[model samples]
Target: MYPHPHALEAVAVLRVAELLREAERERRLPRTSLRRRLAYWLRAWAEKLEAPNSQLGYA
Candidate 1:
């Protein structure tokens, strides 16, 4: 069964918060290159997701 809209949004917010926590952990790592790569990939993904003009039906 499909989730309710509020449930879906809650899950999304939780996931984003978890990702932010993971990012913060990565930032604390001593491997600068790895952190940079992670940031780069996250940025690339955000850009790719944001640049899509097609309606994703989320809103």
Candidate 2:
């Protein structure tokens, strides 16, 4: 069977988040900025979506 659509979306989001982290590690992102804050929240949301017990109500 194919993977769930939501699962695929979550993986894509998580990959983008990982790239943001790599940019930060390379001193590309600002230490205290809106972009960094948004990235942080995006990563958190992706993690929640990727959780086994996600509350998104997917069957």
Candidate 3:
């Protein structure tokens, strides 16, 4: 089965967040751009997933 665009985007955002958190833990400066981009992607993904009377499942 083909994956949805929003699902792919959500995965990308989660990966970025994991990288940023690791960088922060290592005392390295986390890139602001990455954080901002993650936020935007997550917001868009959430909007797509959250629909009236619809149940969404994530893998």
Ordering by TM-score:
2, 3, 1
User: Judged by lDDT against the true structure, how good is candidate 3?
Assistant: 0.62
For every candidate, C-alpha RMSD to the true structure in Å: 5.9, 3.4, 4.8
- Candidate 3 lands at a TM-score of 0.52
TM-score, per-candidate, Cα-based = 0.42, 0.64, 0.52
How much is the lDDT of residue 22 in candidate 3?
68
Candidate 3's C-alpha runs over 4 A off are 30-56
On residues 1-59, what C-alpha lDDT tens digit does candidate 3 reach at each position?
Answer: 99876677666656765665666679686558976687567656555555454344454
lDDT of each: 0.55, 0.78, 0.62
Instruction: Highest lDDT: give the candidate number.
Output: 2
Best by TM-score: 2
Candidate 1 global lDDT? 0.55
lDDT of 1 by residue, 1-59 (tens): 88766556545554654575586778754557875676666555444444546143322
Candidates 2 and 3 compared by TM-score, better number: 2
For candidate 1, the clash count comes to 0
